[model samples]
Target: MPKLGYTAAQIRAAEAPLLAKGVPLMIRAAQALADHVTSVLPEPSASRVLVLAGAGDNGGDACWAASFLAEAGVQVNVVPVMGRLSPEPEAGARESGARILTEAKPVDAAQLVADADVIIDGMLGIGAGGTAAGGSPALRGTARDWALAVHAALTENPHPLVIAVDLPSGIDPDSGEVAEPEAVIPADLTVTFIGIKAGCLQGEGAKLAGKVWLEPIGASQHLLGVPPAVTVS
Candidate 1:
């Protein structure tokens, strides 16, 4: 059966109460992500996972997931594009012995993407816009550079599996429209939290999001409400 898709606003509303009650939503999300990552790899211990972490909760999820991967003996390297990371995630990554690349140049980023067996896109989430106008100049530049680097590497090898934390960086969670398609990180598989997003099933989303996986994280359907539209069967 096709999963129900919820808007960004709807997911936020559903998560609010759970967060208020002190649910470990981010931790749950990271665990689910790590499990899926292991499922995709032929040898979890031999795989190299590269995470592109932005400065937000989405990045935190990726950082935590990286920690799990590292603990499982996977070679994990995290590149913080936004130059900042949440304290909890930083601690998790540090304690797990994941290599955190604090200052990565363009060539360095490209090399990392080329060497990775799996690339986790945690640069942006539903709340942030992927367009040049919507984001700060530094962020927009960073996303664009990373996307270009990944594109180049894929053109050569096409071996690294790309996994997105939420919706692919630049896609609209509500409309599935992409303001900057070139800058969007295309995903081979996307692990979405709370519920399926409307954007993942429609328009550019269908093409950008190869295979979509939904993780409810204990959120109820009643709390998420009805979606504005459905784009998948």
Candidate 2:
């Protein structure tokens, strides 16, 4: 396997063709995540899932996956901890006919986050750049606070299994550098999209990544014409 860390730009560029082909990255990501969650769940039949969805595509994925789990008769809660969601992906998850807790339920997310069997950390992704990206002091602070809550819950409560979408909430995807280490919500399993990155393979990023999984999300086409850093014979 190739070892590398993908920048937010690269990941977004890769999504171009797939998005064009009508490939639903969020849906596919969610489905893959849901499948994995199902396999390892101590009791998939009757489990409570708490999805900490941010405002980005990562959050969208968690929302969709929670919807699937909810439909299966599992108790699922979609916590939009911050920001909003993408249109199509959010709509798809809504159609799955699950209960979504908007910003209105911040208290609920905080409570369920402490007592849930599983927590899907979809707070951030590679696209973590621009105004909302590496994170300004304010954004990082928000993420740091979120992390503190999770850490407290994990230590004091049931210590739920965490499955992160893409990178953890406060981590930098391109550089794999962490600003708010305290806010770093380490993943028990990370369902990543496209190819692997440098950060997830080494450094503090590795520990945070935990068990890494790659989903194509139909993004290879975008890399077809681009020159790769390495070419094996």
Candidate 3:
């Protein structure tokens, strides 16, 4: 049976209690992401993965996943497009030997995308405007530039598998809108946590989110009685 999809608010509400209780949601989600990434690779240890991390927990999730990938022998390169990352996950990535590309240029981002076997998009999470933390609906600054680089690189070399952590960076998680279409690169697979998001089921979000995979991380019980905002076939 197809699962129901929730809005950002609904998912966040459900996650709150777990987070308050100090559940290791990010780590579990990262493990799931790392497992799925390796599952798709022919030889994971020999693969090169590029991670686009922004200034949010979604970025933290990616950084944690990078640590796992690095430990698994994958060459992981992380670009902090938003100039910051959640401290813990960032440290985990560094400790696991993932290269942190602090200097992010569009040209360099393009080259990284071109060379990657897989690209993990964790530039944003579900939110009303852009991020759950509240920002412009459209990607701005280095994030936009890097996204454009990714779009161009994919256009020229479409070999890399693009994986979105939760939601595609620039798309609205509730409405499925793309305010700046060019700033969002389509994902080959999206490993969303807790629940499927309504955005992934419709509009430009559906197009960008190629395949949706849910990694609930024990949030299912909390969401069990709560009605979903959207359902899919």
Instruction: Give lDDT tens digits, candidate 2, residues 37-144.
Output: 777777766788877777777778887887778667667766566646666656656776655666534334357776678888887776545223433322343444
Candidate order by lDDT, decreasing, is 3, 1, 2
Name every residue pair that clashes in candidate 3.
Answer: none
Query: Which residue pairs clash within candidate 1?
Result: none
What is candidate 1's lDDT per residue for 1-233, written digit by digit as tens?
Answer: 66567677777878888889999999999999999998988898888999988779889999999999999999999988767788889889989989998887556766787789999988888666323225321237666677666666677777789999987876877667876676777899999987777788887977898899888878755454455456456
lDDT (CA) per prediction:
0.80, 0.68, 0.87
lDDT of 3 by residue, 23-49 (tens): 999999999999998898889789999
Best by TM-score: 3
Compared with the true structure, model 1 gives a TM-score of 0.91
lDDT of 3 at 62: 96
Which runs of model 3 end up more than 4 angstroms from their true locations? 127-136
lDDT of 2 at 182: 59
